[model samples]
Target: MLTLAHALLPRIHHLAVPLLSGCSNDLSSRRAATGPSNFSIFNRRPTAENRSRLQALLSEERYLALDSYQTFGSNKKNKEQEATKHTKDIKLQDGSGTNSCQEQNSCLENQLETYEWQLKILHAVLTASGEQEREQLLKDHSGDICTLIHSISDKVKTEVRTDLNELHEKHLKSISEQYQSEAEELRRIHREETAALNEVFASSEKTLKEEIEGLTSELKLFKELKRRVEESTLKRDLQRNIETHGSPGEFWEQEQESLLFVIEMKRQHLQEQRSKLLQMQSMQNEDFKVRMENYQSLIQQLSREQNELQEALEQQALQKQKLSQEKEELLFKLLQQRTDSCSSFQLPPVLHTHLSPS
Candidate 1:
């Protein structure tokens, strides 16, 4: 058992060393290569590959560890039973004969205690407790715990990393899908808008084309009606002139003669009007002379009346001045008469002075 335990120790060390170092190197390299990867979203293959490798190594290491522990556990159980029986046998022996038995019992108890200690360490490592508990276990069994911890910690790290990777991949996938769906919706909206705009533009263009056609037809009809009316009026006038005259030559000669006769009549009428105008002009000149004499006589009479009126106004102003002076003298006499009448009463000097006018 001792030799087997020693052989297993080296083997466990060999197996644990490579795994711990490899996992450490990988973790450090990954951390260094992808610094502050809080927003990383692209790389997944490398992590998956590393996870697969870790899972394989961890599975193999875990199977070996559990297998070794199972054999150890079974052996420990058998040894415990045997030690219990042997302790009972030592207890049954005589008191003086118990020295060698007690020594052997002590040796067996120590061996069992060491085995139990080792079992406790294994249990603590497998259970993967809190930091304090782990630290305590490590302090109690540093060498054995070191070998066990490397494999167990790597397994735990691999599981946590795998879970995180899976979660990250799911999140990235969900975000990508959502983005794609939104982009597709936006594209659909754009297409609908484009189609609607195209329809509106087509309808507007069609309406404009129809309006242009209608206007063009109306313009053509207006031009045709105007031309027809002008032609009809021209034809009627020509027909009436043809009926009045014998032929085109006769019409032209008659028109020329009629125009000459009308011109001669107008000239005669104008001459008579000119003679009447000359007579009226002479009569107006005689009336204007008579009116000028009347106007001059009226102007002389108005001027004489204006001078007489001005003299009357000046005489009135002088009479008004004399009346105002006489009124003032009468007012003074009336005041003096009042003062003389008031003197009989022996009025106060102040009253007399107040009654006197300035």
Candidate 2:
């Protein structure tokens, strides 16, 4: 039993060495590759200083190896605990199954021990018996011993094979169940995370769309207000121009026509005054001609009376002188009146200059 236990220890150690090394290697690679960026969607990662510190720690071969060893040990401990719990549960669930296998294993061991003891005893008896007796006994029991040994070995082999098949099937079933459960959990977590991300995206998109619409509305309102303000300003400016400079085409035309009418009336009045002055001048000239003819005829009659009456010659002379003086005075007054009328009839050059363009 000691020898068997020792032999199995070596085999167990050999199997564990590669597994431990592989686990250590995998842990070191994972640690080296993992970064802060792997955890977040925003891509925020560890600072360069933190990365440098981690690299510095990893740079020491002993520390790196120690860390990996510690990690692997912790993982192994956790796995061992889980395995122990699972084994306990299985024992609780199916205690009779393990008990039966143990009984069968003990039974097979007892049978093997019995078979070995029998062979040992037979060897001792043969040694103790004479050569002839031993030969005779061997010839009688050799075939039977061979057949019995063969039968026992065949039974043990069949039992062990069946147990191994059952164990393998149980292990396969357990592993498949574990994988299925883990896959389901992973799928559930993925679905929840995807839904959360989609919800966030939808909310953000809605908010942005609303903000854009609001901004667009505000812009349109500003444009409309600006247009209205421009229109109002233009209207105000037009009103001011009308107040200062009068209305455009129609008002200007009316004002121009009125001015022309006033100018024409002024011109007609000036012409009428000139014609009346000319008629008054002609009448004054005719009255002066008649007065001169009457004076000439009176002078001739006074001369005939003087010739006919010498005694009143002196009085006649005086009367003729008085008549000549009165005629001169009347002629001077007519000339002065003609000059005043001519001066009064003359129009200003400014009026003629203003009317010429029209």
Candidate 3:
């Protein structure tokens, strides 16, 4: 019922504004015809002597003729102000001092009928109480549907205030408790990890110094081999680019596999380097002899340049993973936003449920 009323309001305003404009023109015509009420409507009454005065008055009121939207808004505001004055008070046409039992029953019956209609409207809105979180929404706010008609009639200011305050307080307390629990868990983990990383970093640095000396020599050899590999890869990429120059889309589609292959090779190279680092990290935990020959056997034939290229590739892999994650997260956030908008559009069927009277 409320939705129907709301839908009607704008169309009504559209219709009413033009009607009023017509009436105003009629009134102005009447004013012009005052001296001769029976005069034809098309007849002009402005005299030559009063022409300047008439022009000035018309110019000042020109805004009324040109600005229909402004006029409609002003009229709507006046209506709201009038309705506000009627709040908490109903006017009876007859100003009788007293009413008999039959008259009183008839008045009560009329009020019941009106209330029933209001109840039906409320039911429609309540069906949307899945809480789309829209303010100034048309939904029935069915949270208070448990209240009886008698209770509704006798609702006091204190009752409303208390309900609102209680809901707010309860909501606040839950939010605070949730925050505190998360903070406490984070603090506990920080304390535990700080001590562990300190001890490990101290031991790891000593081992890393010993391994670096051994690995440097091995990396020098690998560096030469890696340079040749990158040069070969670049040449292949250039050849492919030249071969498929006509269509960019088709070229990219063909290149996808090659790009993925290159990325995979780079990933494998990083994994190999990471495995070497992991060994050093783990060697610190072992009880084996401090023989430097084990480091020699463990070290690959990679040269210094290969190690540097491998490090750069590892960084690129990390960045690529981060980018992929961010893209997924952005799409997920967009999907969530779309879901929220769709939620707001609770159809008439769902709203009809909560809107129904208890």
Candidate 4:
């Protein structure tokens, strides 16, 4: 069943949600006109709107009773599930039972639903025989039969049981005078049941009286509330009419003033927000500007050092050229002395120049 409900949940929600949403307007309209919805105890195929309406109508006790009902339902479902398992176990062990009997057996736990539906098969069997045989038949079907009758008319069962118990108690006290020895034991058992039923009857009567009083109080309150609502509605209509046709110039002036006040409030709010945004943006821009300035200053300093290094390289190159020229001159003088002593080879001319550092 859980698996089945799980699979069906999306579909159920899909179907139910639209219906529930559509109902909400009606519920809200009803509440606005009156108060809460009528139902406070019973919930039948409840929609979301119905649930909301019920919440307003329900007292704390009624709400708690709903919780108790859910818990009780859960317990009953667990018992039915156990009974189903028991039936399945019986089926697994033997294959002798007819299909109809098996179906009836499987439906045994559901006997709690309706007396007629549950006891159909039992009545069919019982009516096919005589009274002596009927007693034997009734004994065989006692479980299913009792459950069906009790499930169908729970109040009737209680009342009948009470009557039987009283009869038994009377019989027990007057056993020698009234009942035979064979009936004595039954009388004792019957007496015990009567006492219990009388107590239940008394309690039920008290509960009903309390419920009636509470309902009466609630009805009185509802009538008072209705009167007040009608008065409020009338006042609202009168105010609307007054606003419709009176003193156009003065009305427009007041409306203008209200509009201006609203605008001023909004303007102040927006202005504050704008100023905060500008301050944050300007702070970021200032930080960016500082970093840009630092970068430009670093570039200028690097350029100055680059020019100085170039000037130093020029001075070093000039010094090297002067040294090379002096060595060439000394060599030329030696060559000229060799030529004056009777040499035939001619020497090439060389120019020497010097550059200072910039």
TM-score of 4: 0.23
Highest-lDDT candidate: 1
Q: Judged by lDDT relative to the true structure, which candidate is superior, 1 or 4?
A: 1
Q: Write the per-residue lDDT of candidate 3 for residues 63-122, one digit (tens) a residue.
A: 333354355447656765776535324334454544253364456445444433444433
User: lDDT of each model, Cα atoms only?
Assistant: 0.53, 0.48, 0.46, 0.46
Reference-based lDDT, residue 32, model 1: 59
User: How well is each residue in 18-60 modelled by candidate 2, as lDDT tens digits?
Assistant: 3223323343344347632332111123335533443443244
Residue 67 in model 2: lDDT: 55
How far does residue 194 in candidate 2 sit from its true spot (Å)?
A: 2.0
What TM-score fits each model? 0.33, 0.31, 0.18, 0.23
CA lDDT, candidate 4, residue 173: 51
Q: Model 3, residue 28: what's the lDDT? A: 47
In candidate 3, clashing pairs total: 17
Q: Model 4 segments beyond 4 Å from truth?
A: 1-253, 329-358
Listed per candidate, the RMSD to the true structure in angstroms reads: 51.6, 65.5, 34.6, 58.1
How would you encode candidate 1's per-residue C-alpha lDDT over 156-241 as one tens digit per residue? 44655676556656655665565556556655765685576567656755765686577568767865886687568656756787
Worst 10 residues of 3 by lDDT: 349-358
lDDT of 2: 0.48
Which residue segments of model 3 deviate by more than 4 Å?
1-211, 216-228, 240-249, 285-358
Judged by TM-score, which candidate is best? 1
